[model samples]
Every structure is written in structure tokens, then in C-alpha cells.
Target: MGFKPSNKSLLLEEILDALGQLTESLSWEIGTTNLDNQTEFRALELLWWLDTSNYWTTLYDTINIGTSYSQETIQHFFWDLTHLISRYLGLEISHYTAHPEKVAEVFWPILTNHSEPIEIRTSALNMLMMSQPTVSRFLTLYWFMQAEPSQQMYNFYYTTINSMANSKYPCYDKYRKIAAQIVRFVQHKWHHWSTGNYLLDYEEPMRGYGGIVQAILMANQRTGFPSVLRLTLVRQVV
Candidate 1:
């Protein structure tokens, strides 16, 4: 006996719901690292296969539909969902597709939207920067300069600059001067505090400062500067 259409649809829904639950569980269990067993790796491999086999069509469709949602809650949900997916995928969506420009088209609005949370904007910005580093270079630099000085923003800034520093592309050369200016601005603006030893003792703030120094040194090396010269420059700035 053949199954009815509604029965088949219900069965498919159950299967999808099960897959969603499995995905969520694996995400919480594995996170971005610490794969302790073969089972976890196999589960991740399966999910990766599914996402690639569909060429991220499900993700693209979800973003397209979610973008049209007028409710704030629904929009926020999509933002978080996309952010998680982006984190899990690691590589930019363009790497998995032929038409890479389309990746930028979808993410640009999210990155440019001021109302979006900084975290969401940064995620979108990272994806765009990875997909088209040269095209987005100026915008990324602009974002670093314009964004309010905070640990979160600084962390994102460090991530962007560090990636550019390590890249084989020459995009980091022209921006070296701008990067130096940004470092100086950040130091003068944010580190002009009177409290010295007390504030320096805080682990989080110190880590942030370390990140800034590391990023500056990397950027300096990209400019063909010697390590000693870079360290001296970092000392002067940081």
C-alpha cells in the first residue's frame, strides 16, 4: 500500500525536526574545537556534507526569507541563526559557490545596518571581508576607525587586521599608513587613562591590549618592516 501525500509530508517534517535537534546537540557538544571522539567528527562531517551538497541553498533561502520578515524578534532570530551558521562553516560562503558576488550582495545590508547589534554586524563584515578582501578593504578599515573604542570592537579590529597581515594579497600594503593612524588613535583615545597599575592588572583589558600589539606587529611586518623596527613602533604606539 502506498502512503498518502499528507503522511509523506508529516514523515518528512519529523525527519527534518530530528535533524535539527541532532544539529543543535552537536553544536553544543562540539563547539568550534575539542573534538574528543570519532562519533563527533562523523556527525560534523555528515552535516558538512549536507550543507555542501545543497550548496548552502537552505542557508541562502533562509536568509532571503528572513530578510523580508518585518517583526523584530524574527529578524533577530535570523541574525543569530546566520551568525551561528557562519561560525560553523568557518570558510566564506563564496568558497563553496561559483557566483561569489552574490554572497556579498546578501551580506552587505546586514553589515551596513546600524540598528543591527555590533556582534551581528561584525560577523557579516568578516564574511564579506573573507569573500572579497580587496573590494571590502577600505570599508573594513573605515569600520575599524569609526567604531567606538571598546574591547569587542577592538577584538574584531584585531581579527580583521591580523587576517590581512597573514594574507598573500597585497591589500595590506596601501592600508599600512591608515592602520598606523588607527593604532595611534586607539592608543590616544582609549589608553589615556590615569589609573595605571590597577587597570593594567585586569586580565581581560590586558588581553585586549596584547591583541592590539600583536596586530600592529603583524601589520608592520606586512609593510616589509623588520621585527625589531616593528617592536619599536608597537612600543611607541601601545
Candidate 2:
């Protein structure tokens, strides 16, 4: 059948059904298949009920439900579903006048959790970094120590720092100004990444200074990496 807007009450009912099904699917041998279609459909249905009282609650229920949560899946959900969810949030902000902070509550945690897959955490890191100052220094340090940071990880951290520096925080220059303390924190703590796509050959990685703008600016000063920063960074955030 063709698409038709459900009555508000009916919409709520449909959303509930979908949420139940998604949660059920995630818990079983079913969810791993057709994720693309499932997430797109899931996101669309959620937005249709944005004004309903449990709009965020329903979404959170899906995320927090203990039976099926994992960093890899959560990360996949973001990369797969952020387009839908972020747009939904954007619509809520513009049309529904929803609060960004409410959205951030859910968004930041998923990104900062190093235990989660790198892609999702990277996406979340960029999301919070672009819209707010919510990166977890501890998480960043933890990941850097674990293994090589991906292009995704490097860009997210670097851009986050740069954006903060250019913003109201004038003390951003003080980030790396602490001598090599910050550098050592990253070098000693973070996994030494080998991908030429994310890191520059400069004295330190873009994240070394604490913001991405500084990273890009310094990056501009040298041929640090050949990949497009926006392609590497913004799509994940936006």
C-alpha cells in the first residue's frame, strides 16, 4: 500500500509495535539481517511519533534494553540510523521545538564508550564535538592506548578539539601549551595508528592540541594526510 500518515494515536501504537519488533529482533537470530531496511524503517516510524509523550523514551528503550546491547551494534545503529535519528532530532528541534540537551543525553554516552565499535563511537564523538563539547578525555585516552585509531577516530578527535578552540573557549591554545603533557597522553596512551589517511606527519596528531580546527589549521600548514577532512569527519557528524 501507499504511505499514509497514521492518526496520532494510531501512530503511537504502530511505533510501539515496531519498537517491540525491533527489540525482539535484536535479541534473537533475526536482527543481523536486513539491518539497512530495518533501521531506516525504524527511524521513519519513530519520527512519525515525535510529539508523542514517550518519543525519546521509546527510542531509549530500544537502546538501553539490556538483552541486546553491544558497542558494535550501537555503533552500527548510529552509522546506519543516525541519518534518520539526527534528522528526526533536527525535525524535533525545528518543528517540535525539542531540546538538544535531551538528545545529547543519549547521543554522548554511545560515542564516548570505548567498548563500543570504533565507527559508532567515532560517529558519536563527532556528533557531540560538532554540536557540543562532550568528548570523553578518558575514553579518548583509553582507545588511543588500545589500538591504532582509525581515520574515523582521528578526525573526530582532531575536529572536536579544533571546534572547541575556535568557540568561546579562548584557553584552547593552552591545550598543547602544557608542553608535551597532552602529546604524551596521546602517544603513550593511544594505540600508535599507522594509517596515513588520518594522521599528519607533523610533530603531533591533530588531536594533540585538543581541537580539530587547530588540527586542520596545523594540517593546512603541512601535508599531514591526503583524505578530505570533511568527507572523513562531517558526514559522520551530520
lDDT of each: 0.40, 0.42
lDDT of 1 by residue, 85-182 (tens): 44454434444344445545556676667665555555555555444444355455555446644434344555454445443323234544444444
lDDT (Cα) of model 2: 0.42
Candidate 1 local Cα displacement, residue 3, angstroms: 19
The model with the greatest TM-score is 2
Tens-digit per-residue lDDT, 15-72, candidate 2: 5555445555663335365754564466565555455565545454544442254333
Point out where model 2 deviates above 4 Å.
1-6, 27-31, 39-43, 49-79, 83-100, 134-155, 167-238
Number of clashing residue pairs, candidate 1: 0
Error of 1 at 212 (Å): 18
